[model samples]
Target: METFKKGTQRLTDNEVDQLMKRQPHLLKQSYDQIPNLTPNSQEVISRQATINVGTIGHVAHGKSTLVRSVSTINTVRFRQERVRNITIRLGYANAKIFKCPKCPEPQCYQSFSSEKESNAQCELCKEVMTLVRHISFVDCPGHDILMSTMLTGAAVMDCALLIVAANMPCPQPQTQEHLVALVITKLKYVIVIQNKVDIIFRDQQAALRNYEEITRFIKGTIAEDSPIIPVSAQLKYNIDCVLQQICNFFPIPDRQLQVPPKMIIIRSFDVNKPGEKPENLHGGVVGGSILQGILSVGDEVEIRPGRQSKNGNQTTWHPITTRVVSLYAEQNELVYAVPGGLIGVGLLIDPSLTRNDNLVGCVLGFPKQLPELYRELEINYYLMVSVVGAQQQDGKTQKIAKIQQDEMLKFNVLSNETPGRVIEVREDKIMRVALNNPVCTGLQEKVAFSRRLSNKFRLIGWGIITDGKTITL
Candidate 1:
């Protein structure tokens, strides 16, 4: 019997009832009755364990977009990245996955949202959910020229997500190289993301064919048994599936927290703004993940092979001693940093020294706890049969030439890259090489080997530092 004026139309009581039944969410409720979607208000509890997952693939594979969709933190920092739509450097983001109470599938999840309304509903089923796990994402640049950067990103990862564009043929140049890099890094858990699935929705046959090609290409590689997840990062379609797979495949590895703390400095910067007061200027910030043990504020740390200095014709490296003034995880200040996730350490050092990533490639630990610095390294070399990313006229990988004595090669360990000259090639594949620059590394640490192909240094294989007793200073 009731009649309500709705602009030009008058709706009856029965009509309004039916409309409200169809959309129950429109019905207003009391403040207490309304579901809370505020992620911050909720006690965001995460298991002490965390895992770092790296994204690797060919250029324009939508790695940054995928990362932004999942994590609360912004991975891309450079203006060049925003303008070019390509990740130029290693980026990082962190996300917490939650399980929905009403949804049976684990894929029905949502990233932590600041908005209370958005957090109130399951992203897929509109159900209430709670956070279950927290994970750190390492976004690696996919450009062919940034292969060394990708290798550095992979070195810090416990697992990897190899993204491939569905619109293009599988195993593109950088794609092949990235896969090989994963193998060399010995990353066991992998999930292949077939991105841009939205573009192929119009053509059923094309989508099916692309899937088959991708499946076949991965069969013979190290990721043969890994799952292929079809997703549309732009549309956010099947993103939940990606998260679900991450929860299933990427398990936290055992950590030896009782040992002396060791961390590889992947990124270092002077976080001071220009024209700031001298007293307000903060110290240098070093960002990276702890490999093992725990580091706390006020801990005295030594950076080995710190800054390069020239004494006559020889370059010498000396360790730098500094105190940890502050600790940060995902931009939030922390009292300490533990193994398993990425952290930023604020050092009480001169800001000018850490500007422009000068502290990158330095290893940090307690004083005298680090391994010896070496300029000469003996490596147990193993060369790949073919060079990935190099294509012949027939679309096959070109055969790699054997490494010769006295030939120069690029050696990558952690975040450091140095030119090495092969001094002696033994019959057993062990090579004695002299580094053009000094590196602070321990024995048995993995080193990626690269050779000059055409004009670029293409990744060839991997080796281990068997002997590095020769110190530079």
Candidate 2:
């Protein structure tokens, strides 16, 4: 650590001022100005994304391909994902949306990759376009086995892009299930992307029939009014129209700056290379979007349900404490980060603790200000009418039954997942669960439930934390 800091120097006040003049998102201090910050504030969106837009649909429907077409990023980076040609983990990328104030209607809007200059010139107008929205794409896996992972991603989503294949019939298996996850998560804003239009382009009547099928599919769902944009992600056709629709349809959500800092960890890594010099080794880096409040450089933080220990048949969790060494949004460094785009927090801790996403799903905040660690939860549950993502039997979807005692279920709480068993049921609407691993959660946090069917877990219901059993530090 000393070697890593030996030649480096902190920026002077003049340097900070100069950088802020060019990159308005640098080294933000003072909480007093937070209340005045809007989603489109030049200081905010100019540097970092304030909206989390998720890409979701069935597997092989061009979800990742569409994101790559717009953002120029291939969200699938893992070895297995590349090998399997699927998104196994929740993938992320950032894009900046700019609009030419003088241009007409749809042609005015354009989306550039994260590294693009905030004030880029418009291609059509030849004038500087103003940055309107910077969004982080939470690319969720469409595989049935990763349904709970999708549910966890939904927790941070402000809006979603439902990518449906133009060639396939409406509502594929994971497509239906991902939509249901969005509904239960209460995500209101959605944009439906009819990708792979090139495949069905030659058949005009079939295309129209498929379009009508899409319209009917979303008739009563959350995306009922969402614009269905047809495009070929592979050929990058009509992608601008998709960008225009995104800018027009999705409204920036209300940001929370007055509350305590809350962040859900989706990915954590030890960025050090193999066999690096001891003096050059840095600490662990944790990445996720802030839920509320502000995180600053040098502030001390705590992670809940941290490390586990067992003593004589009793298990205990110890909260991990560390100080923030740096903050980042993608490759852009930030002195402070608020609730908005995904944030990467550098910590002064052992790299092993965060290597390979060891800290994923943990909640981070100011010490003693975080929520309780629950070993058991009492929730007011609502079971879905049918099991989602499960294959139909005898031409009928599998009906979800009531919560049964001793039956095991999968629960996703704030990006953290745990296997839970039904311990008790009351009034047929309330249930008690014993979690296999403790979770750090606040009261009334929405929890998505899945039950195993045909040897695979299917989304069965949802619940709210009415009460819980907590363990001592």
Candidate 3:
């Protein structure tokens, strides 16, 4: 409760208090102390963001711009990201949606930063605006090489915002790939943002044509019926409409708060600076979204497939067990964190172990309660008609061939990505894969498969884990 460190940003005791003072609901710093606490509990809602909205589309399509304009907080914090003018790693920002009861319809719905007072006042009626929804945007990289990074972000998404640049064609290469990815992950609720409308504002005919092209592009796809809203993220235009749709359409899913807590490690960091005293050196900080249950400070947690070492041709992974020292959602410290948005957990361990995302794709949960780790799996697989973004020699889409014996393919299950060789392809759509890097997964889990297209793996289809060879440690 005194201090916490995330990346290079450190908040002192008084500074932490100054940030937490706005949310009255976070009065107690204990998990059990909260009365009848749900994910929507006032204290939690006032302080924490519950919904995880993933912003995805082609590169330079304004995914980051849309998130920045709405959240007022830039997701691109990395120096490399700023220099490249694109998101390389997964970026995040939280915003609170407020609604004035007296104002008319969608006009009353507006989005503000997470730091905005929970009891926000409406600009129109001066009425106290109720906090309707608090959402966190998972700003995924849209670069072709960063497709794997985008899939990892898609794992925890409750819904998606598909950005389509009006200046570009309806379906760019990554746009199609990402849409198919949404289908592979079974993300059904989507909002299509036709961004860069300002570039086409002078031409009504061009705008209408672009809209029709978008409709045709999404036809027969998961986003066929998704509402397409024109917006200028650079100009901050029609942002309220996006907020209104999010509040109106996106339903709050039922969270598994009673189950044993499970969180997927997506980002990890060493927050210590050079020349810091040994006594003041802090442990690693793990950042991710909890899939189920609640996690609190002082809880002993285990990260599976944690540390890997190879010895004389035999490979083994050692699990790391550490006590939760602190829990954080952005700068706001919490007694306990619910299962949504990206949360950073401070662990009492050597920071070097978690440094530079060494723990990314690891699973964190109660000790000995997680699913088994698998080195080989038997999956019921299915391939799409053709690769979404690739063309063939005959001037048509490239159809995917059958998985060959001993072919190397990429698989993404949960937050982990591993390259696996086809060990056996049997009848009844059953295929066995020997993972290059073992992953911790359970029976009946869904995995997205990909192939090397021009030296980069492009998503082809998905499969279900029917059986697997588990590793006993």
lDDT of 2 by residue, 351-429 (tens): 9999988888899998889998999999999988887656575768788888889999999998898999999999959
Best by lDDT: 3
Per-residue CA lDDT of model 3 for 167-190, tens digit only, reads 887889899999998988898899
Estimated TM-score per prediction? Answer: 0.86, 0.93, 0.92
User: What lDDT does the true structure give each of the candidates?
Assistant: 0.78, 0.85, 0.87
Q: In model 1, which residue pairs have backbone atoms overlapping below 3 Å? A: none
Model 1 Cα displacement at 470 (Å)?
A: 3.2
Question: Measured by C-alpha RMSD in angstroms, how accurate is candidate 1?
Answer: 14.3
Q: Assess candidate 3 and give its TM-score to the true structure.
A: 0.92
Ranking by TM-score: 2, 3, 1
Higher-scoring candidate on TM-score, 1 or 2: 2
Which pairs of residues collide in candidate 3? none
Residue-by-residue lDDT tens digits, candidate 1, 401-438: 88899999999988778899988999898998898877
Alpha-carbon lDDT of model 1? 0.78
Name the regions of candidate 1 deviating beyond 4 angstroms. Answer: 1-49, 113-128, 393-396
Model 2 TM-score (2 dp) = 0.93
lDDT of 2 at 184: 85
